[model samples]
Target: MQIPDYMVVPSLVVVVIILLGIAFWARYKTVGPDEAMVVTGSFLGSRNVMSEEKDRKIKIVRGGGAFILPIFQQAEYLSLLSLKLDVSTPEVYTELGVPVLTDGVAIIKIGGSVEDVVTAAEQFMGKPTEALKAEAQEVLEGHLRAILGSMTVEEIYRNRDKFAQEVQAVAAKDLKKMGLQIVSFTIKDVRDKHGYLDALGKPRIATVKRDAEIAEAEAVRDARVQKAKAEQEGQKAELLRDTFIAEAEKEKVLKIASYKREQDMAKAEADQAYFIQEARSKQSVVDEQMKVELVRKDKEIELEAKEILKKERQYDAEVKKRADADRYAVEVSAEADKA
Candidate 1:
């Protein structure tokens, strides 16, 4: 039984076409940055993935290649990008019972673990990107309110380091719940309750005022004591100087009087000695005149006695011659011879 020749050639051509179709089915795929892999056809809802992460443990499907069951495998991309969250704090009561209003910015991004993708998938599965962003804003407000309200205003100012630490602790916990990890939670401004700072400053000002008054009083007392002591010392010095001057003047006067008295006594003694010497000289001249008068009286008495003796001698010679002449006849010759 030989078949027709046209039927045999057409059958060979149909077999080659079937083999080419099978080869084409083994290799066609597409992957992008923002999409995650999804199982299709026979591998639907399974761990098979086609992603840019080549070393990923999840099943990988290559680009531009045909998978065995593409209908059971698929990829849905999710964005991994940074976001900004504006945190606005309510006028909440602080630990010191003061109402405060605060506001700041929060920086957040996706977590590092594969659980991060798993967590994002759960919350925002069917939701849009804007809805997820709004949820992040609400979380920022809640974390700031809980952390900032626990501190007083003075403590916050003195210990901003501690405030930042507490914010990190609170944000890390709450952001995890919101499918976010905080890069930073910064407080930009804090508006305090009305008139509370002024109240605290009043007591410290009064204490400074009291100290100033005490210092002023002590200075005044020290000045008055010093002035009184200076006056007393000046008066004492003046009196001592006057007493010394008067003593010196009295001594000078006494010395002058004693010198005058000594000179007067010396003059009087010199005059008395001169008068006694003149009287002794006059008495010696009078005694010499009395001796001369006694010598002249002795000379006169001796001359009168010599004259009587001469006259008696002459009379005796004449009487003897007359008797001799009368007796001349008998003894005149003898009398003349005896004469």
Candidate 2:
């Protein structure tokens, strides 16, 4: 078939546009936040900024877009998320010669630094998360076994955090070479076939119980002694109270007796004064009667002296009259004789 001359120019232009569109689409690729896109190919003697060596030309794009020459470069993705692994070891002998099995878990991820990403790109590029987990589990189990061999079973059981730390420290170097880092490692359990841990704790438990019983007995003895002392104090207080009451009664009786003696003395003094007053009154009456009888005897003696003087005067007059009669008779007789 012969083509038209004007149709040929337009057909050539349409073909160029289609090829350029295809090339543009193939050169531009977008990478997600959790993924790194690695591009590798011949660079026409130009240096690749993502790689240090000029012979092995490669570029890594993360969280953005990159341009790739259609035939000179290729693109691949690696996950940036963490991976979990299970760690289990068969029965292993400890430093104390005890056989034990250990079970644990670990979390790992590809490092995010430029150097670490380069390492990850060279080692784990295009590998699945399961493949990375399997690799990490094998490395961690070996380390766990080695650490267990250096420690006693009691140390492993009591300090699981320390045990995990030791395992992570030892395994971190190897995992780093494979471009992975351990976020965490934990030991879930440790067990033995012979029940050695249970047997080891028995003596300590028995000792604790025995000490508790002894403390309880000592506390009871102390309480009994305190109770006895309290009873003795109560009895002494009662005895003191009774003695005080008895002394008080005796003092009251002595006061009453002394008061009665003073009252008796006062009564005796009053009676003696009354008797002396009565005797003085009787003696005054007898003295007045004796003075009246003395006056009556003096009047009787004066009357007797007057009566005797009158009788003596009468007798002297009678004698003088008789003598006068005799003298007259004699003178008459002498006259008769003379006649």
Candidate 3:
């Protein structure tokens, strides 16, 4: 190790290269996507055409790395992300002379364009995020008060979106001076010392509820009427069905009675015919007996003739009685039909 005289120069050269590389690495600065690295002091003039009117020696790098000369240049980061500011203004008089208190929030951020970045660098290059937020909030509050003074409490309460727009319109000009932009402006609350908005809405709410109740009652009434009509229709249909059934039953009964009456008449006619045939045979037998008696004795023949006449009269009377009975049955059937 002590005999390396020729390697000394090469060793020193390698050490110098390594040291230079370390220095270069140390001067290399990077800016994240959410931030802009502002390099100032002894930098070349700005390349932005919009900033040509003003002489500013600064450079801004975003989402990339840049080489910074340690002795001549300094780097600062300005967040590109939005910053939220809460604004609460004292009681301000509206056009209608009503005192109103307003609370709101604003979202703002540094402009990302070349001109905007140059302007932001000039105004807030070394400032913290809070300082930018305070500046934006102050501008927003002042414009909010001015807008509120031109609107009534009712307008501020009802047209909250318009109120926010008006405030943003007025405040944006002031913020643009500092190279800031308003992303959103919102009215969180607007109130008065007295209960004005609540009193204004009470009657409207009551009217809406009353109208709803009336509509509900009308619906219920209509439902009841429809139900009653349906019940009536059902009853009418049932009554009609029962009437039809009763009429059908009456016709059936009439048909059955008529059939029975016809059967009875046929049976009666058959019985009458058989009775007449039997009477004729008895009369013939009586005649033969009388002839035999006449041959035996004249006195016996007279008595037998008288007996035969009596039997004939009795048969006639029995036929007449049966005919009267049949007529009576016919009359009763006619009366039943009429009834």
TM-score of each: 0.43, 0.54, 0.60
lDDT, residue 33, model 3: 91
**Top candidate when judged by TM-score against the true structure:** 3
Per-residue lDDT tens digits for candidate 3, residues 1-339, read: 473989899989999999999999999998899888877767535442232334646677878888888878888888889988999999899999988899998889888886677788788877887788888888898899999899888788878999999999989998888889999999999887777767766887899899999999999999999999999999999999999999999999999999999998988988888899889889989999988777778766666787788887887788878888888888998888899
What C-alpha lDDT values do all the predictions have?
0.67, 0.81, 0.84
The better candidate by TM-score, 1 or 2, is 2
After superposition, candidate 3 runs with Cα above 4 Å error: 2-9, 43-54, 214-339
RMSD of 2: 24.0
Q: Which sequence of candidate numbers ranks them by TM-score, best first?
A: 3, 2, 1
Give me the runs in candidate 1 sitting further than 4 Å from their true place: 1-69, 193-339
Checking candidate 3 for backbone clashes, the offending pairs are none
Clash count, predicted structure 2: 0
Q: Which ten residues in a row have the lowest lDDT in candidate 1?
A: 56-65
Query: Candidate 1 vs candidate 2: which has greater lDDT?
Result: 2
